[model samples]
Target: MLGRPVSLIEADDASNVDTAIKAATKLVKDDRVDFLMGTFNGDVAIAVSEFAKQENRLFMVTGAHIMDLTGSRCNSHTFVFMPNARMMAQAVVPHIVKAYGNKWFMITADTVDGKAALQAMTEALKAQGGDVVGSVTTAFGATDFTAPLMEAKNAKPGAVILNLYGWDLVHALKAYTKLELAKEKIGVGGMIGGEQIGRPLGYANNAGVWGLIWDPKINTEGSKRFIQGVIDKYNHTPTSRCYHGYAAMMQVLEAVRRAGTTDTAAVIKALEGHEFDGLKEGRSYFRAWDHQHVQDVLVGEAYGKELGLGHYKILATVPGDAVAGGVEQNQCRL
Candidate 1:
């Protein structure tokens, strides 16, 4: 992107805050990397973002969806490329509320990301004159969700909102299906859900309306190219996680190309308010104020079987502007 060969170095933080800081330190001090990117855990990402700020390096947060990463805890050195909890909630909550009704039961992973999801969903629900009737918090890596699922079922809310992700989400869905919550007219959905969560749970078990980052069914030219590249290189379909990594890295490189230097301040300037094709149907840009990547968010309904490249059927394509709240709503001063 800079018209020069660029070297890449990687480290795994194991989703732990301390481990992530250590790994980031090595990348900045030992490897002398010009940029830092990638994190999957909210707390870990926050810790590393502070570390990056201290070191005066730019960090592109790719996966973690905690709102504070771009909200109250936002810093000039860190830019979030993934949709945060508020963005997802704004896009999906209405569909879920309309499909299932006003009352909700929540099953949230007890962590920063999960908390953000819970809060965002709650706010969105209330905005629509709805409320959470009952909720439960689970450990980050809990494997069994029988108790919580039963509680949610017994609450008999119009829908159950899962403020969980990854395997926690998968396990919850397993129990949700095993207990036949849908059969009882209790719908289920969440702020974020996509092929990544659905594939492991299997098509038959993946049920819900969800906020999706991306899906292969997106008909944009950029989307097609991205999907083909992933299929060719990895021999598998790409998920939203893949989209986050690819798009974030691409934007970072593009910023360097635009700035004509890897200098931190210059690149940061290049990225601020910069617009680009996000491989989606709507506008994409890093908001100049908060550095949140504002882009399209999709609402999808999971099917009992695969629909070609995905297990979810696209229900609506919400433009980024409609969901990404205005400056007053974004609590970041940076």
Candidate 2:
């Protein structure tokens, strides 16, 4: 993680926890590597967190939205780069309730990611002036959602916030369409709409649906530059996930640079209450109580039709708040 460029290793499978454990064991024992990155999956992130603790190595988790990473299982060696379930919940729930209140159902993945997302969203809704009709959680890699779709159709939520990623979200939408759930419900929630769900599914489907996306189209000069860089490098604009990785990489590298050493202790010290400049949405910091980064969340409705680079039609910004809700924040002395 220091003195040289960070190296990445895949977790082997998105569905299998054992594969991630094996990879982690190898990385810590055989490869003799320092801090690890990449959250191929939420379960993988959890597995890798424990591995990092046992091996006494630093771990920077990417693409995981589970609250438990920093929650009950939080360890000093683990540094979460991706937004936690609570942060994501904080980001979307307020806006969703304000815009479309009283009816919400969770199309959750049976996996850790889906369950956690559903829990977070439910809590957020209750926190706001909203009610959760009910939610249905399905197992990971479920192909047929007919049963759940039937339940959803009966429940008839105003919004179905799908807490899934990768090909899973795509499949869920397809199932929703096949079952005509999209036709019945207002749209999905807790996700930034119109970016991914729009392209493969078509703009027509995304219409009226909203997702909790971080609008990269902000007026900030730095945001423009960051978006341009992604487009220039990848030939396609960045989405929320891309932005998360980019910002996290930059933040981690900066923390290491500021600490002037890869020593975990020093880096941790420098990172606590640290502010990041020259980045889009300027002047964000990592809280000392919880490691969540202080930044803004984007709220947008689907509209654009372009592939990869299309922008959200209308966007509202929500300022970042504390991500200290995980078990680490509880201070339980067991």
> What TM-score against the true fold does each predicted structure earn?
0.98, 0.84
Clashing pairs in 2: 71-327, 110-138, 161-189, 191-211, 191-212, 192-211, 192-212, 192-213, 193-211
lDDT for each residue of candidate 1 in 1-334, tens digit (9 for 90 to 100): 6677888898999999988988999999999999999999999999999999999999999999888998899999999999888889989999998899989999999998999999999999999999899999999999999999899989989999999999999999999999998899999999999998988876789998999999999999999999999999999999989998898999999999899999999999999999999999989999989999999999999998878888889999999888888988778988
Candidate 1 clash pair list: none
Native-structure RMSD, model 2: 3.4
Model 1 residue runs over 4 Å out of place are 1-3
Q: What is the C-alpha lDDT of each candidate?
A: 0.92, 0.66
> In lDDT terms, which candidate is top?
1
**Pairing residues by index, what is the TM-score of model 2?**
0.84
